[model samples]
Target: MFMVGRESEAFKHCTPIPILGVACYAFGLHLLKTCGIMRSIARADLDFSYITSRLAVMSQPAEGLVESAYRNHAEDVRALLEGRHKGHYTVYNLSGRRSGALSLHSGDATHMSGGNVVDCPGWKSHRAPPLSALYTLCEVMYDFLEADPKNICIAQCMDGKASSATLVCAFLMFVNMFPRPEDAAQMFAVKRTPPGLQPSEM
Candidate 1:
C-alpha cells in the first residue's frame, strides 16, 4: 500500500471521511511531512482546483448493482474470505487502464486481485480529467455509490495527492453536495490536507 498526502497512522491503510455527501477513504502512501515527500511532489499536485464556471455534471443511470461485485471475483472465494487485509484493496483505480480493473461483467480481467482501474489517464496531478473521461469516471463512481448508499469507496492515485482528492471533490459536487467546486475543495482541505497558505492568506 503506497499511501501518500495525509500524515496520520490512522490512515495506515484508509480512513473514512465524508466529502459533502460522499464517503471517501483516503490513503497517502508517502511518509507524512518528510522532505522526500514534499520534494517529490509539487504544491499544485495537492491543491484544490478553483472553478471557473458551473461544471456540466453527468446525469446517467448506473450500469448495474456494481458494488462489491469485484469482492468475490476470484475463482476461489473461500481463499479470499480466509485472508485478512493489512490495507484496503485498491478496488477501484481511476487511471487509463483497459483491463483487469472492473469486475468480469464490466471489463476483461480474470479476477479482482488487481483492483479495478478506470481508463482515465487524462486525470493527473496538475489537471482535471477531460470532460469525456470525467463523464465515464464519475458515472462509474456514482453507480457504485448508488448501488448501496452504505458503500464506502476509496479514492486513490499514484501518490494519493491532488488526483485522488480531486476525484472526491468532483463527485461530491456532481451529486450536488456542494454548489461550487471550491466549496468541495475547501471541505477536503480542512478535513484532509490543509493548504500551505500563510496566516494572512488563511
Candidate 2:
C-alpha cells in the first residue's frame, strides 16, 4: 500500500497518461527509479479457501509439478490440497541439472539473462507464465488468507519496490471484494519507512 523512490520531475509529468502500453512501460521504469526505499503495506489479507479452491479447479500438471509436490511434502494429490501451506511459494531449479526448489531469488540468475547487450550481475530473473501463473499464485495466496484472515502475509523483493507494487495490486483485489474504506483501513495499513511516502504511495 506504500511505495517510495527517488522523486523525479520526469515521473511526475509522465504518470498521468491513460494509455495501457505507455503505462506498463512507465510502471516498470518507476519501480527501477524507486530502488532505495523499502515500501510496504498492510491489508485485509486474503480468503485462502477461495484461492485454494480456484487452484484446485485449475489443476493441470506442468514442468514443476513434481517439484511442487516435493516442496509441499505432498505424498499424494489429496495431501497437497488438504495442507495449509501457502504464501510466496517457490519452485526450485527447472532450468538445469542442479535445479531444485528455490524461492524467486534462489534459482540460477544466469539462465534468465536473455541476450541482453549489457550484463548485469547479481540481478535476479526468471521466466514465469505471467498471465496464468500470476493469477494462480494470487489464488493460492487468497486461500491462505481465507484460512486465517487475522494472519498477515508479507512479500518483498530484494529491491522492495516491485514487491510494494505487487502488494498494492493484491490489496486492490481484496478491496474490490469488500468495498468499505473503514473496513479496509482497519484491516490493513500501509507501513512505509520515513513516513513521508504513505499518502502518495498508497
The candidate maximizing lDDT is: 1
Supply the TM-score for candidate 2. 0.27
Winning candidate number (TM-score)? 1
Alpha-carbon error at 157 in model 2, in Å?
0.4
lDDT of 1 by residue, 79-121 (tens): 2212321121223344333324223334311222222323344
Give TM-scores for every candidate, taking all chains together and pairing residue i with residue i: 0.43, 0.27
How close is each model in CA RMSD to the real structure? 14.8, 16.4
Instruction: Give the runs in model 2 whose Cα sits over 4 Å from its true position.
Output: 1-129, 174-202
Tell me the number of clashing residue pairs for each predicted model.
Answer: 11, 10
Worst 10 residues of 1 by lDDT: 52-61
